[model samples]
Target: MTAEVCEIVITAPDAEWAADFTRTLVETRLAACGHQTPIRSIYRWDGAVHDNAETRIALHTQLIHADEILRLTNQSHPYKVPCFLVQPILSASPDYGTWIIDCTTRPEAI
Candidate 1:
């Protein structure tokens, strides 16, 4: 069966949390690579509009492993409602794409 590439974006309250979460994900082989960027988010929550600065972690993983990845992320996340957005990769550099697929595949040690 052909493998699919996917990117998932998760937001954390701060950079420290983002780093910790991303490290766990990579160490567990749930993600191939994770990039964290600082961002300012403005949204309504509990009937109040608010603005806050947050860190966003984008995870590169495989489609087949999406559910497990999300499950683990939510379990470890600090927010009551963590943001987990998944996007399919339409196309990518062949070598990098292959690497993403290889990294997310089931490991022999697991």
Candidate 2:
């Protein structure tokens, strides 16, 4: 089967949650790499506009594992309404793409 790459972005309330979430994802092989960046988000919540600085984790994984990744994120996420966004990878370096596939693939002798 051909491998498909994807990027999943999830926002956390703080740095700690971002760190914990990234660790869990990597340990479970749901993601190959996760990058956390601080972001200032302004959005409407409950008819009121709110602005806050948040940490966003960008998870690099295969499309085949997206459902499981989303499920686990929602299950363990701290936010009442977490942001889970999936973006397809249009292009990437050949080596990095191969690495993502290798890291996210199911183990053969498992």
Clashes of each: 0, 0
Residues 1-110 of candidate 2 have per-residue lDDT tens digits of 12499999999889998998899888878899999999999999999999999999999999988899889888989887899999999889899999998887778624
Q: Candidate 1 has which clashing residue pairs, if any?
A: none
TM-score, each model? 0.92, 0.92
Q: Against the hidden true structure, what lDDT does model 1 obtain?
A: 0.86
Residues forming the 10-long window of minimal summed lDDT in candidate 1: 101-110
Candidate 1, residue 65: the lDDT equals 72
Using lDDT as the measure, which candidate wins? Answer: 2
Off by over 4 Å in 2: 1-3, 108-110
